[model samples]
Target: MNIKIGNNNKISSSTIANTVNGNMEFPKKSWYEKHPIIGGIIVSVIAGVILIFSFWADIVKFIEGVL
Candidate 1:
C-alpha cells in the first residue's frame, strides 16, 4: 500500500483515483475484450444465493433441533 516517491516526484489525480479504487475505469468493451471469462460474475451470484438460503431462519432452526 506504500507508494514510493523519489526527489523528482509528480502526482496526478488519475493515479490517486486508481490507487484508491484498485482498478482503473476502463471502457466495458475494452475490459471484456481483454478478459472474456465473465462467468465468474454468475458463479459469484449463485454462491451468494446459496449462502443466504443455507443461513435462512427455518433451515437454522431445523438443524438446531436435529443437533
Candidate 2:
C-alpha cells in the first residue's frame, strides 16, 4: 500500500511500519507424559506388583500347606 505525501510525492506502508512473527511447532507429548499423577499412579502399581512377585516364597509356602 502507498500513502500520498503531497502532489507527486508518496510513501509506502512497509517503509512507515514493520512487523515480525515466529511460527513454531513443538513436539507432541504422550497421554501419560501430559498427566503426571496418572503416570505416577501406574508406575506405583507396577512397582507394587514387582514387590509381591519378589516375595513369592511366602505365597508358595502358604499355598502348599493349604493344598
lDDT of 1 by residue, 1-67 (tens): 8666654465444344333556778656675566667766767889888888745888889999999
Q: Model 1 — TM-score against the truth?
A: 0.32
Winning candidate number (TM-score)? 2
- Ten residues in a row with the worst lDDT in model 2? 10-19
Error of 1 at 32 (Å): 14
In candidate 2, which residue ranges exceed 4 Å CA deviation? 1-18, 54-67
Give RMSD to native, each candidate. Answer: 16.1, 9.3
Relative to the true structure, candidate 2 reaches a TM of 0.45
Could you tell me which residue pairs clash in candidate 1? none
State how far residue 25 of model 1 sits from its true place (Å): 38
- In Å, residue 39's CA in model 2 sits off its true spot by 0.4
Q: After superposing candidate 1, which stretches have Cα over 4 Å from the reference? A: 1-37, 53-55
